[model samples]
Target: MKITPELVEHVALLSRLELTEEQKAQFSRELSKIFEYVEQLGEVDVSGVEPTAHPLPQKNKFRPDEVVPGLANETALANAPETEDVYFKVPQVL
Candidate 1:
């Protein structure tokens, strides 16, 4: 889990970043700490816990769909700035 300056430079290159030597060294130290912490977390006991996609209960919040009468063509086109018969009129597209 060591984060060397070379590793930092490689990641910087992948991320399209231009880091100075000082920044690379700084990031190397910081990333090492982060990886070390993650490694430590991996040692904690979670054998009794069940795997879950989310920690909280989830439910679909939508109302049931019901057969409903659709708007009439005249009602739909009533507010349009421009219309041709029952259809909306717009500027011609190429």
Candidate 2:
């Protein structure tokens, strides 16, 4: 899992990135360190460990859904300059 300059170059090409030689060298070192840390993590024992999707616990709050009185049609359409039967009318586009 060692990240070399060639691997970094290939990955940069795949991601459509224009990286300089210095950037490629820096990324190679950083990515290699990350891979080494991940390899170390693979050595940890977790035979009876439970897999979790989230690190923290979560719960959903619930409330009753009910219909409430809303604005009248006349009051709703009062601000509009154009109104057909009981709805606002706008210019039609072809």
Leading candidate by lDDT? 1
Clashing pairs for model 2 are none
Candidate 2 segments exceeding 4 Å error: 13-16, 59-94
The C-alpha RMSD in Å for every predicted model, in order, reads 10.9, 11.4
lDDT at position 33, candidate 2: 92
**Model 1: C-alpha RMSD to truth?**
10.9
State the lDDT of candidate 2 residue by residue for 1-94, as single tens digits.
8899999999999999999999999999999999988898788899999989998998987888888889999999999999999989999957
TM-score of each: 0.46, 0.46
Model 2: residue 13 alpha-carbon error in angstroms: 4.3
For model 2, what is the alpha-carbon lDDT of residue 36?
A: 89
